[model samples]
Target: LWLPGMGAAYATAAPADPVPWRAILASWTASHVAHAVDAAAERLQADGKRAHSSQRLTQARLRQTLQRAESARTVRERRSGERQRLLAAHAAWREETHQP
Candidate 1:
């Protein structure tokens, strides 16, 4: 006789929703803020000489560098996530279409 708990498990349904943009933006901003702090520290160590506009330029440069890096990273992550979702959808579609 077949055991009650030995049957095949049912496939779980996918969620009917998309990624939240606001959440993504918040994450991107928070990551950049952290990077900015690191940039400031690096600038302080690299230059012992201080000019008239040294502090202002350093802050500006740090913010710019952090912004660019964060933007690129965010884009890459979003694209990677999109690719994963597309692959999953394709697989599910194939399975569903071929089922009896």
Candidate 2:
């Protein structure tokens, strides 16, 4: 007989018969091992999910950094163009006035 919540088995025998101790012990051991395996599988599945989530978060952060870098590059290019235009206008004015 298997006991609930005890993970053990018991056998009854008459005086002329011997209890099947080996079979009872084997069944109990198998049951405990199966439970342990199931628990380990559940933990691995949970860890996998966490790892996948972390990878997605890292990817999103990388994309954001790239976008910020691109924006800064565009701003720098625009400022450089403006500076060139201002210098050209100043040179033209100096030529018209013959300031050299």
Q: Write down the lDDT of every candidate, Cα atoms only.
A: 0.67, 0.79
Which digits, one per residue and each the tens of the lDDT, describe model 2 over residues 1-100?
A: 5555333354432334365655566667777899999999999999999999999999999999999999999999999999999999999999999977
Task: Judge candidate 2 against the unseen true structure and give its global Cα lDDT, from 0 to 1.
Answer: 0.79
- Candidate 2: residue 78 lDDT (0-100): 100
In order of listing, the candidates' clash counts read 0, 0
Model 1, 1-100: lDDT tens per residue? 2222222211121234253444444455566677899999888866645653698888999999999999999999999999999999988998989943
* TM-score of every prediction relative to native: 0.44, 0.76
State the weakest 10-residue window (summed lDDT) of model 2: 5-14
Candidate 1, overall lDDT?
0.67
